[model samples]
Target: MTTPTDFLLWVRGPGFDIALVVFILGVIIRLLEVLVLGRKHDYSEPRGGELGPGLKTVVTRTLPETGSFKRAPFTVIGGYIWHIGFFISLFLFVPHIELINATLGLSWPGIASNLVDAVAAVTIVTLIAMLFSRLTHPVKRYLSGPEDYLTWLVTFLPMLTGYLAYHRMIDPYPLVLGLHILSVEVLMIVFPFTKLMHAFTFFIARWYNGAMSGRRGVQS
Candidate 1:
């Protein structure tokens, strides 16, 4: 008979192994394709330095520009809150910190559980609000399609499952916990192939834009 403990063990062992393998290999392949698939010669004379602006933009774009913030204050502000909260919960929560310590032999002090829980809830709320805005806003609605919604759900599910598991909201706690871990595995497998690549490509795209614009004597 399949027990909750068995389910949890499989998720933590084989499921995790599969997810990590796929995530890492897929990411590497995708990166190689992006970086190696295209090349061109730009013979135009330089009007300004490229490296400085490239580095600058990599840092600067993390904060919304004045015009962007003015145009989308809610998005800009909400994005910051969501990002900060999500990262804090992911990195600083006790369980996650302990997992890192166990797996990688690195350790750090985690924040209080209550604080992390509060941040997680807030980030989840922000994500929901952002999704609602996307659905309601005319421009965003027009631009978004099924993939956007699908990505949103997949991205959101791990957090939801993790929260539920942590709180033991359902019976068979081990099963629920396994579900959470499995949800994360699903996310990892899909991440490299989805818009989630933006987590990495954002820097490259910003740098290229900044460098090109700098060469054109414009600050981007």
Candidate 2:
């Protein structure tokens, strides 16, 4: 019989190490493939050119427009709310920050646990809202497949499990904690292989688009 202690050890030890290795190497490999796939040279003469405009475009995209909020209120609101909560819980939660501090020899002030809990609850709510939208909206529903929902679930599990464990909603504390760590490892392993790659590729893709448009002499 596997004791809770053994399960916890596995999750925190080899399981985590394997997940980290796979996550790092997979990200590196995928990133290299994208970078080395070199684009065709654009030989056209420019009417105007400023890399600044491209950079501006990249920066601007980070902030959604009021028009977009009006157009897709739920999506815009849910997106911002979820991301805010996600980051707060991921980085500011006491345990998570402590883990990072221990691992990287870096540290930041952690927020109050109550605040982290609230943010995590918000994250769960927003994620559910987003998932519901995906299931009900015609365009999103049509565009989505198993992989899309799978990625969403994979992304959602660690948050949900952590929330449960934090509150002791689950009886066996060790098992729940182990499950939470396992979910994170699962997410790391699945990350590069799924649409979740957006976590990393989004920046590169945006930079390329911005640079190309900037070189074209058009204000992006």
Candidate 3:
């Protein structure tokens, strides 16, 4: 049987290192495009206001009252939960935490293993629910593009494979581990080119909306 130490060594080797590099670079490039190219348009325009009106009102409104939260409550809630849960699982998973500790000399306190496992389970279920809602809800269905479906698959595969790998449900750790890594690698390579780009764009978009509303003296 391959020991955990051997598995860790594999993760620390060239394949994992290259995948990490690609993920980081992809995210950075995507963010630059969103910040630089996405800013060329005048977001103060009426059409732009439709994209995020509550953001526009941020300067005048208390943070809690941002209409964005109210306008599309379910979408916002689901999105937030999925993102937070995904990030927590990604960073807190034992192997990842160990890697960070080893490579960067940093470690975050983590929840108990069982609790963390529960959270991962919840995250996966919530994400699946969210994807289903997007497909079934008329308004969401109308708004979703092909890229949306693709993104869901790309994101789902990694979480699912990671869970399977961690649980060791099917013996042969190598196969499950390889699947998890492959899913992640695919996600990393495609990140900058898909709707997943929103992860980087959302903050910039919010700030732009806020600035525009402030400049126009309009209640956001």
Candidate 4:
């Protein structure tokens, strides 16, 4: 039988490498598809400039409009909490920072592990709540499909496994750690093909829409 050590080694080595390759290649191919499908040439005369409006929209779109917030207070607030908590847990954790530094030759100071733990716990709760909301809300439930739920599962697993690993809630440290790494690998592998691609494409889309509107002298 394979030992926990073996499982850990495989995940850290071959498993991570495979996931990384798929993540990179998939992202590149998808991005190329989008970029290659260049928009139709606009013959209309430009009233202003595309660059300024595009940049402005990119910044403004980070927050919901007042009307949107009023309409979906839980979504807007919960989304903010999830994003903030996820970022803090991902970036400010010491082990994650060290891993990033080793992999990418980038380094940054990390916050307290306890703080990261708190954030991770909050993020996990927020994700669960979001899933519940999606399941119950008429419009969201109507639009939901397999990919949406799969995306949520893949996204949730990494955090849940990582938290469990950190707390050593599972038996055998190596096994738990291996599971955490594998969960992250799963997340990476599915990211480019799923709704998670919005992490990258959302900004590009917002900019494109804003730029077109700006060219027409309309505030996006």
Candidate 5:
């Protein structure tokens, strides 16, 4: 029988290595594909500078208009809350910061662990609410597919497991920590191939849209 210690070792070592390789390769290949499938060259004369408008759009498009937010307050608010929570949980936690420093030789101070724990808890709750909304809202439910649920599952697991691990809620500490690490590895492996790729590509997409509009002398 594989003991919890054994599982922990596997996930912390070989599992992490495999996930890292897959994440790097998958992201690189996807980026290359996007680059190779470049947009058609425009021959039209430029009416204004493309750089300024492109950068401006990148900033502007980050938040929706007031009217749009008012119409979809739950989505807008929930989205921001979870997004910020995820960022803090991922980048501001001491253990995660240590991991990043070990991986990239970059180090930064992390916030209090209690604060991270609270954020993770809130993020999990927000995700649940989002899921409920998706399931109940007719238009959202109609538009959602297996991919949507799968992404949500993968995203939620890490937060849930990490919170459990940190609190030592499970009987076997190593087992819960191992599960948390494994869940994170699963997320990393799935990230490059799924909508999670938006973390990286959203900026590229926004920049492209802005640049095109700028070239046409219009706001994106």
Candidate 6:
């Protein structure tokens, strides 16, 4: 008979090893792309043909007045909540924490089980809402391509499966866990080539914006 121990072994051994390798390779490829092929723009001047005012303008005046935030607040908020919750669940979930404690001798602060459950639920819901918004919103609909929707599907499935595994619903816990791991493996395999690449590029873009504003004597 299949036991919890058996399932745990599969996850911690081959499943984890494969996931780790894929994650590492995906990150390396994404970084290489950014380093080698990413776009280069001179943001030294503002959108208008001027020196973008000054550092004060870049820092306080121009940047804050930018309408991008108001254009898509739902996407922004959903993205933030989903990401934060996913990372928290990944690093702090009990089983994962136990694994880390065993393999790496690292200990993280433990959260109550109920709180963890709540976080996972919120993450999944927000992600779903974001997906729905993408489908229904006119602007998002206009902008989204097949790859965009596919990326969201790929990203959302693992989270949903993982949460199901945690709750031990439907299939046996072991099977659900395996499926979760597999979904994540698929995501890792496709990370560098998909819209998911934003995970790696977002920070770079933010930094570039900040730097350009600084150089131009504008407030960001």
lDDT of 5 by residue, 38-154 (tens): 988899998778888878877898888899899899999999999999999999999999988988999999999999999999999999999999999999999999989999999
Summed backbone clashes in each candidate are 0, 0, 1, 0, 0, 13
lDDT of 1 by residue, 102-185 (tens): 999899999999898888898889999999999899998999988888778877888788788778897799989999889889
Model 6, 63-132: lDDT tens per residue? 3233756976777678779988988888878877886899899988877777888999999999889988
Better of 1 and 5 by TM-score: 5
lDDT (C-alpha, whole model) for all candidates: 0.89, 0.88, 0.74, 0.94, 0.93, 0.74
What is candidate 4's local distance difference test score?
0.94
Better of 1 and 2 by TM-score: 2
TM value for model 1: 0.93
What CA root-mean-square deviation does each model show from the true structure? 1.6, 1.6, 5.7, 0.9, 1.0, 5.5
Clashing pairs in 4: none
For residues 1-220, write the lDDT of model 4, one tens digit per residue: 2899999999999999999999999998999999999989999899989999998999999989999899999999999999899889888999999999999999999999998998999999999999999999999999999999999899899999999999999999999999999999999999999989999998899999899999999989
Which stretches of candidate 2 lie above 4 Å from their native place?
Answer: 46-50, 65-68
Q: Rank the candidates by TM-score, best first.
A: 4, 5, 2, 1, 6, 3
- TM-score of structure candidate 2: 0.93
Best by TM-score: 4
* TM value for model 3: 0.73
Whose lDDT is higher: candidate 1's or candidate 4's?
A: 4
Q: If candidate 5 were superposed on the true structure by all CA atoms, what would the RMSD be?
A: 1.0
TM-score of each: 0.93, 0.93, 0.73, 0.98, 0.97, 0.74
- Model 3 lDDT-worst window of ten: 56-65
In the range 155-197, model 3's lDDT, one tens digit per residue, is: 9888898889889964677767876877787787778788787
Q: Flag regions of model 4 displaced more than 4 Å.
A: none
Candidate 1, clashing residue pairs?
none
